[model samples]
Target: MINMGVSFKIPNEYGNHLSDILEPLPFNYYQWLINNDEIHIVHDNEFTNQFLFDEDKIISGEKLYEKSKNNTYYMVFVTLRAFLKDGTIKSVSKYKEFTESDCQIILAVYDCSYVIFWCKNSQLVSKMYMYALSKGYEDIKYITEEELIKNKYYIE
Candidate 1:
């Protein structure tokens, strides 16, 4: 069974250099994902007005892991699908940048601070919450499907 994921206000303090949660979380908090999942960059600020926004790009986990780990940059949203033990990647929507869909993982950030993550896998959310708590970001909050629809973080 799946549960509604969680949200938190990522600390945006001076000297924090919080470029985006994707950066810190990818390396420090959720590194395991790189090896286990195929990453899809749903949308990004740097890719504004580019095909990356319009087309689905299924990037290999190893490739992304090599490039993004420990780096500080901004990513608007990303969806992840696991590479199963049998070595086949889980299928996902051709495009789910907007309107929630069931993917293995969904990480979305808005205003460079507020984040909402809903994953089919609840353990991932639990670990993410733990990461936030460990970093003194204890404001992780529950979000309703209604709030998600209203927030429209994916919409400009």
Candidate 2:
């Protein structure tokens, strides 16, 4: 497995308050985001919510919560699902159209912000919990349902 170093940030509008989450990792991307305008909120929006979540199926929120609850770490998972067309990683998929010849990399990213807050707040994190609550659909993911499932998994 290739551990692609996270030398990038998710843009400021995605919220720059990552200290609560990225305190452990030597986050080089945070500074990169601060300096570059190309990696702005709108860009992150297209790259993250639109490209990543919509194109690739990533599990976030509750699923992520359960995955690393004991560990204090936050990460945005990015999957580049691109294959060679003629002789490169740039292949045109049926889903999208492309005329370029460069290596085509289908990127899928997931921003896991909940893990950080869970560590910082511990239990007295009403504010953080509120944020997690807002991330899900109230009717689909009710407290009672969560209790029954005893599992934290969300796909979007």
Candidate 3:
């Protein structure tokens, strides 16, 4: 399995506020609409909202995107799905702390002002990567799944 993600510096010209981190997650990642089931907003840090605690946060991606895109800081759990040896499932009963060296884990640190633009679809991955690169944003860097899993790149 392959995971795709990218890390880049948000130039002051592009706006430094938290919302700026979302600039790369535009049309290429699929529209912020109701029809697409390909995406899901699995977890977010709104304690008051019950959905944030659901094991499966099926809340519409469009709605969540609209609501959380501008928040200065918010933690998001983008699918805790993991695989076991026999092609069986291995899911955690509760959210546990994940370390950088852990294998096959997806972790995004919110306090750092970073968002992982991740996807499993190769075609979509390629499209997003190329699109971000094409934007000519300064300090934009690609993070291979290996790099991400191993914590090889620095966003700052």
Ranking by lDDT: 1, 3, 2
lDDT of each: 0.44, 0.27, 0.36
The list of candidate 1 runs beyond 4 A from truth reads 13-56, 74-102, 144-156
What alpha-carbon RMSD in Å does predicted model 2 have with respect to the real structure?
Answer: 16.2
**51-148: candidate 2 lDDT, tens digit per residue:** 21232123323322232333223234422222233333332322213224332222223453222111111232333344434443122111222221
**Candidate 1 vs candidate 2: which has greater TM-score?**
1
In model 3, the runs with Cα more than 4 Å from the true position are 1-3, 11-58, 68-113, 134-136, 149-156
TM-score winner among the candidates?
A: 1
Task: Give per-residue CA lDDT, model 3, range 80-134, as digits (tens).
Answer: 2222223333332222222221212222322333334444445645665666567
The candidate that achieves the highest lDDT relative to the unseen native structure: 1
What TM-score against the true fold does each predicted structure earn? 0.48, 0.20, 0.39
Q: Which residues of candidate 2, in runs, are more than 4 Å off?
A: 1-15, 20-109, 112-123, 130-149, 154-156
| For model 2, the run of ten residues with the poorest summed lDDT | 29-38
TM-score of 3: 0.39
